[model samples]
Each structure stands twice: as structure tokens, then as C-alpha cells.
Target: MDAEQAHGPGGPRWWRGRGTPWRSTLLLTVFVFVGSAFAARMQQGERAELDLFARVLLLVACALLLWRRRYPVAVVFGTAVAVALYLGAGYPYGPVFLTVAVACFSAVVAGHRRAAWTALGLLCAVHLLVAYWLYRWLPPSGDAPASLGQELVVAGWVVAIVALAELARSRREQWARERAERAQAARRRADEERLRIARELHDVLAHSLSVINVQAGVGLALLDADPEQARTALTTIKSASKEALGEVRQVLDSLRTPGDAPRTPAPGLDRLPELVEQAARAGLTVEVAGEPPRLSPGTDLAAFRIVQEALTNVVRHSGSRHARVRIDEERGTLRLRIDDDGPATGADAGGGGNGLAGMRERAAALGGTIEAGPRADGGFRVLAVLPVKATAEGGEDQ
Candidate 1:
């Protein structure tokens, strides 16, 4: 949807406003000017002539009120002063009184509570003083009614108008607050989607690249040593490359069309042994000690990535010829613990740079946690715990 046509109160019409307060004030000023001018022309001919100066001053004050919303205190004071000066003239009550109401509202809308109160006090004082004077000595020439009750009723109506305007302003503020909250929620969802995309790409690239790298290395070694073994390794490399390409195409197609066919699900605990076998092929004696749990796809994916990274760490850092991995699921958490004996030589090796970091991030995203460090048993250990359902800890039942 267009920005102005977003989901909001007032059918999005409220969003179609000028960019700045100055423009809004200009529009209002032009409107007030035109309205006041029309009202003045309709006055009785003699009255219009006598109060020409009063009409001009009142129109100028009304037009000036465009800026009242921006600088409420200043405009209210200026307009109030002008109205007080013109009240004694033979001017009609409409325009002068309109200016007072606008001043009070503008002050309130500008968020100046103290100034609005001051403006209200000034408005009441000037109106009361003029009303008293008019009552004590009737201006027979003016068009005002003789009834005191009618005067009070008119004053009450003005007060009600100000209250209504304040109510509208508060409602508009509330709508703005709600709109901001919705925008924040949308941003959060977009962030999550981006993270998921990154996870898929990492898994697809890492596993596929590992297989390709191994096969390519084997092929290079057997280029003359054994053409038969070299051809087989080349075949594995071709198959791995083809699968990676297909997965990449599917990911790209899904992005272009949201309703594209779904791809195969990501592997989890069910393929833990297969993962271990793959590690074994790399000359690492990987021992799987416990039955991995059947978990939700998210938790399962986290576990798979955790084990993959842990074994990769063993192959990369631990000079150990053998590595042991154990997975235990209890109390709604699937935990994987992996340890490896030190490598043969004392040569220092760097640990998981992006691999371990990615594992920790995956665990965290699934409402899980991980720990990795050298163990006291002459080996290194990596541990990860993933929550199956909700992240909250379960009941401490005996």
C-alpha cells in the first residue's frame, strides 16, 4: 500500500497532510482569511462601513493564527490583544470571538499546557469584561441580544468547542502511537526472515562445500595414483555440486515467487549417525554414544548444526584420532555433548572461527544455549542444549 493509504484510523486521510507545521498553518490561514472575508461582506451596509477597520484587524488576526498552531503562545497573545482593542468598536462579534477560540485551541494543540491555561484565562477575562460592560450599559446600536442568559449560553458553547478540540487532539495522538507499534512488529518479522535465509544458505553451502572439497582433494591425489578411484571421487563431486546448484535455484525461485513449491525439509537428529559417518570418512573415528531425540524442526535443525560444527571443530582443532559425541533429551531440552582427544602433535590450531559462532547463534535462535572449552579429560568438549517446544523451563516435579 502507498504510505498515505496505510492501515490507520480516518481511512488514511490523516496521513495526507503537509510535511511541515508551516504549510499546515498556511492552509488554515488562507481558509480562515477567506471565511472571515465572506462573513464580513454579509454584514449590514452601515455596520460594515463603521467597523471596516475592526473587520480588517480581526481578519489579519485570524490569518495570523495559521502560525498559532506552531507558536501558540505568541499568536494567542497577539490575537487576544487585537480582539480586546476591537471589542469596543462597532465590529461584529463572530470574527473577534473566532480568533479567541482558535488561540485557545492552538495553544493546547501545541502541547503548551501552561500557555493554553494562560490563553484560556485571558480569553475568559476579556470576554467576561466585555460581557459585563455590555450588560451594564446596553449598546443599543450593536446587534447583540439584551438577554444575559443568552450571553452565558454563548460563552458555554465556546468552552465546549475547546474541550471537543482537545479530545480530538488526544485521539489523534493515540492513533499515532498504535501505528508506531505495528511498524516495529513488522521490522522484527523481517529481521527473523533474514536470519532464516542466512541459516539455509549456511547449511546448504557448508555441507555441500565440504563434500566437494573432500572429493576434489581425493581426485587430485588419485589423478595418477589410481584413475578408477579418481573417477569415483570426481563422480561424487559432480553429484554434490549438482545438488547444491538445485538447492540454490530453489531458494532463489522462492524469493522471486512467494508461493513457489516447497523444498525438502532440513535434516535434524534423525540424520545424526549419517553425519557421524561422513566425519568418519574424513579419517576421524566419531563415536555416537546416545540416541538423539526426535524434536521439532527448529530444534532438530539446531541440534544437527550443533553436532556438525562440533565434529568439524574436532577435525579442525583436536589432533585426536578419535572423538566421542553424546546426545540426551530430557526435561524438554535436547543436549549434545562432544569431546575429542588432542591432536597428535603439539602444533597450535585455531578453533571454529565462523563455524562455532554460527553454531552458538543457531542454538540461541532456537531458544537454546551452548558451551565449548578444553576438558579436564585430555580432550575438548562442545555442549549444546535445545528446547523442544517452549523455551521456558519445565516444572520441577519430583
Candidate 2:
């Protein structure tokens, strides 16, 4: 993973080897070599007597730009100071100062607003002073602009170039702001997704484990007292185990991103019968009514989970000996209804009913709906209805 991208979103899938030390070193070497070449090509026909000190300073400042992102303010100020001394040497300058201007712009874009302004101030001040001093020393040589008006034109040209560079700086800062906002939005979405997944895990695992725990205790107690009853207990354990595994698989599926590999097919609408069977094995008189058809993969999975969670709740919470699972497909939708004649008293009051909220959340995610409350008919009922497809599949019609 690239060090520059390791801390970024989705965990480094976009780190395409772009942040290596070798690449940075190579780029800096190229910049310094180009600055030296431009320095050597000064003056027309006459061998420009290059000041050794100025040439070395220009090379150092040009090479220093590689660290601009890491130390923008230092590089900007350092380059400005070096360029001043180079200009004061009274020799024709080169393209090295352009590199400093570029670095200043990057600093501005990196959220260092105050530092960027400070560097900009020092840059304009130092360059203006250098121009004035250079003009005084040799206002106009034979090859220089012939008139005061022409000299003023050359001065204007320099100012125009600086203005263009500052414009570039502003653009970089704008781009940086946009990138920051995008990152913040991504982080917020990730946090929300994590919370949702956590809620699902809590609901499914807590409810399933509570039923299994109670059934296991019953099996152990009857093991010595009645062999036939113990056999029934073992059967209940097997059914509960299957139901728990299925719910767990669904939660894992929900946590995965699209195109990722957790492609284990979830038990959908067809699995409602299996859930009712598990309740039967747990010694509850289980009954099923109506019929819900083949739904889309998402709807099917959510519907199955709702029934399974409801059955688990009945096995754990319903004090009565009977529970009914009612399912029906109507008007392009499927509704799952689970009710138990369980008295909300004693152990049943604070019973293992953690999966109810999770089931509701699952239904909501599918663009469906769920409602779980005490039925007016004196039983606990959970009703969930889901569309064949999500609202996101076909957004609101304008």
C-alpha cells in the first residue's frame, strides 16, 4: 500500500504505487537539471558570466520544491530568500522562481490559509524590491528595452505573470476544499453503515442465542428423567441451530458491499416454513396461514429473517404453548405475520426479545415496512410488508 493513501477511504484499494520515494527523487532531479540548463543558456552570443553562488542557490531552491506538500511554508520562504540574493547578484535570472510560485499555490490549497497569505506577501515584496534594485543598477543596456515606456511594459509583463501564478494558487485551494468535503461525506456514510450493521448483528445474535440457551437447558434436564423427552429436546436444538446459522448468514450479507464476495444465498420467503418447524420442534404448537410469492432477492431475504426472528421470540418470550406464522402476498407485496399467546410476565417480561428492532430495521432497508406490538387480540404480533423491489431501484416518479 502507498503510504500517502493508506489512511484514505475503503482501505487502500486506490493506492496505485504513486507515492514511492524513487518517483519523488527522480522528479526533483529533473527539476534541478532543467533549472541549471536554463541558467547556463543566459545572454545572446556572449558567454554569460554566471555567478556560481546564485546558480547553486537556484538549484537548491528548485530541488526544495519536492518537499512543498510536506513543508510548504518553509519551502516558499526559503525559495523567496534565495531568489532575492540571486536577483541582487545583478545577473540575468532563470525559470527557477516559477517553481517557488507553484509551491506557494499548493500551500494555499492544503488549508494553510494564513501561511499561504504570509508567503504570498513575502514573495511580492521581495520580487518588487529585486526588480527596483536591478533597474537602478542597469536601467537600460544596449540590448535592453530602448525607452522608459518599454521598460514599464517589461515590468508589467512580470506582474502579469505573477498574477497568473496567484490565479493558479486560488484554483488549487478551491480543488482542495472540494476534495475535503467529499472525504467528510464519505466518512459520515461509513459511520452510519457501521452502526446499522452493528444493530443487525446485535438483534439476530441476541435473540437466537437466548432461545438456544433455554432449549439447551430443557434438553439437559430431561436427558436423565425421560429419554423420549430428551430426544425431542435434541431435535429442538438442531432446528434452533439451523435457524441461528441462517440469521447470522443474512447479517453477514448485509454488511458486505456490492460486488464483494459474501455471495452466500440468503434464506428468503421460502424459509418461513422452516422457521415455523423450528418452533414446533421447540414444543410450541406452530401454525402457518396464507402464501407470499417469490420476491426479489432483497425482499425475500428480509421477509425470511422477519419470520425467523419472530419465531425465535415466541420460543423465548411466549409463555403459552402455541404460536402462529401468517404470510400472504398481496398487491405486489408480501406480509409476514407472527403472533404468540405468550404472557408478558416474570421471565417472559424481560425475555430475549432483542431481534424485534433488528427485524424492523431490515424491513426498512428494503424499502418495506414493519410493525411489532402487542396485538389487541391479547397476543404479541409482528407484521412486516415489503415490496418486490426497493424504492431506490425506481426512484419516485416525477
Candidate 3:
């Protein structure tokens, strides 16, 4: 049974929104009254005659169940007291035990096991006092003392009911823990995915927009004096904007249809020539050393974005017009180093804080590390060391 159902309605039809389970409790009430009346008939000669007081006691026990979820400790004790009174009145044993069992069950599952046990223990003690010692003062005159065997049987029954309730409480707690863990895991995955998207967007826009900004400036500078040169700058801006838009569309498409393969493959080190060409159009010269190596898609994309952002920073922040990129693989790791001989344009010229942070995030996701700062000489350098082989577990595309 669901843990919520333990405190509320029986099924969808019985559901009364988030309120008390009136319908199901009413049913239990009816069942207890009918069953106890039938048992009274069966024990007519052996027990006291059924009376108004006996029915009222049964009603009291069953009615307390209605508030079991709200006040479990009080309900269990209230039901136990009512049932003990009915027993002291020399009432027959039947479904009368059902009401107290349910109350104890609710209390235990609601994290009031000690209270439930205390109530149950006191009720059992009363049963013993009435059955074995106080029968002379109670109804059903001339009744013999209850046998040790019968008392033992009653003890066993109470133990079984409490044992079952304890088992239910354990299972409910386990299910709750598992549900919390699953929700936490889902939230963690969502946070990671959002971070990944932000990095992708930043890399795509920052690099392309930096190029467009440089070209637009050139176009404005030579618009009248050099018409052909202005036209060339405008052409470069158009190409950069078009490429940036396409990449942005790809990123948004992933959001629209998650889990599907991307229509355009993600950029990687194989696109280095294209990156170099774009930088050249922006009037920044790029030098490449060592051939790009085979890498897992995630590491490849991280490496590509790191170099792209480093070069974009050079174009935007560094006064130097030249940047060098070196790629090398050793053991099971790929290393990328980007360097610019720079007199930085401003104090905050280290790739706009977000760009460097994104690089660090990408490297950390791949169980890699990034080192980026000004060189001992008047220059800035970014070095990333990433594992060459691993499932692209941290990347969306792979």
C-alpha cells in the first residue's frame, strides 16, 4: 500500500483531495460495528450481553481512527482506552481488536512507534487484569479466570500485529529515502545540463561576435576612403554572424528535442583550420603546432572551445595581433596550450571572467585540469590537460 494511502483514502474514488479520509474511515466504522454485533451473538452465553455502552465504546475506538494521520499518538492511545473499556465490560473478542490494530499501525508508520507500543502494552495489561484477576468485579458474573494458554495466545497475536506494523514502517521509510535520492539526482542532472548549455552559448557567441565587432570597426574606419576594404569587412561580418546563428540554432534545437542526435555535429579540434581562418579575417594571426589527435567527443569539444575562447580573448583584449596554439598527446592525456605575446588592453583582459571559468568547468567535467594566466614574459597562456579516452559522459552531444 502507498504510504499516503496509509494516512488517507483507500482509492481514487475515496479520494477527497488532501483532506481527512472520511469515506474509508466510515467504511471501517461500519465494518467494526457489524462484525462486533455478529460476534456478540456468537458469544451470547459466554460473555456479557451487548448493550448501548458496548456499541458506544466501539464507535469511540473506530472514530479516533479518523484523526490518526493528524494526531497519531493521541489516536492510538484513545483507541486503546476505548477498546480496554469494552474488554473490561466483558465484551466478546472479535473485530473490536481491528480498530486498535489500525490505530497502532498508523502511529508506528507515522514515526510514533514508542507511543503505539506503550498504548498497546497498557491495553494488553488491562486485558490480563480483567481476564485473570478483576473478572469478579466486571460483568458476566461467575466467569472463570482466563487460562495461561489463552493469555499466551493473546500475547502472541499482539506481538504479530506490532511486528507487521514495524515492517510496514520500515518499508515506508525506505521508499521515502529512495524517492528523495531520485529527486536529488534529477535536480543535479538539470543543473549540470544548464551549465553545459551556458558554456556552449558563451563559446559560440563570444568568438563569433568578437570577430564581427573587429570587422565592423574596420568597415566604419574605411567606409569612404577605402570602399573595397569596407566591403571586405562587411563580408567577414556577414559570414561570422551567419555561422554564429547556425551554432545557436543547433544549441536551441537540442533544448526542443532533447535525447535526439544534433543535426549538425559539434565543433572539435578538426575545425582548427576554420577557426584560424576566422581569426585571420578579424586581423589576428594564429599559428598552430603539432597535428590534432583523436579524442573522445567531449574532450575534443572542450579542447576546441578552450582554444577558440583563448584566441577570441587575444583578439578582444590583447594588443598583440598574433596567437599560437600547440596540441600534443602523451600517455593517455591530450594537452592544449594557447599563448599570446600581449600587452593586455585592460586589467580585466583575461578572457572576460566567464570565458576562463567556462574553460575550467569543461576541463573539470572531463576529469582534466586547466592552467591559465599571464606568462612570466609579457604574454598570456592557457594550458588544458584532458584524458584522451573515456566515454563522453559529461557532454550532451555524445
The RMSD of every model to the true structure, in order and in angstroms, is 7.1, 6.9, 4.0
**Model 3, span 294-361: residue lDDT tens:** 88788888889999999998998899999999999999889999999998886332235698899998
Order the candidates by TM-score, highest first: 3, 1, 2
Model 2: how far is 208 from its true place, Å? 5.8
- For model 2 the local lDDT of residue 154 reads 46
Judged by lDDT relative to the true structure, which candidate is superior, 1 or 3? 3
What residue pairs clash in candidate 2, if any at all?
none
TM-score of each: 0.71, 0.65, 0.89
Overall lDDT per candidate, in order of appearance: 0.65, 0.63, 0.86
Candidate 3 lDDT: 0.86
| True lDDT of residue 179, candidate 1 | 85
Q: Which stretches of candidate 2 lie over 4 Å from their true place?
A: 1-71, 102-226, 242-264, 348-353, 393-398
On TM-score, the candidate that comes out on top is 3
Over 4 Å off in model 1, which ranges?
1-16, 19-50, 61-82, 90-96, 99-120, 132-158, 246-261, 344-352, 390-398
Model 1 lDDT at residue 92: 44
For model 1, how does the per-residue alpha-carbon lDDT over 167-229 read when each residue is reduced to its tens digit?
A: 855776677778889999889877866776676676666666666666678899999999998
lDDT leader? 3
Tens-place lDDT digits, model 2, residues 195-219: 6667656655655565567677788
Q: Model 3 — which ten-residue stretch has the worst lDDT?
A: 8-17
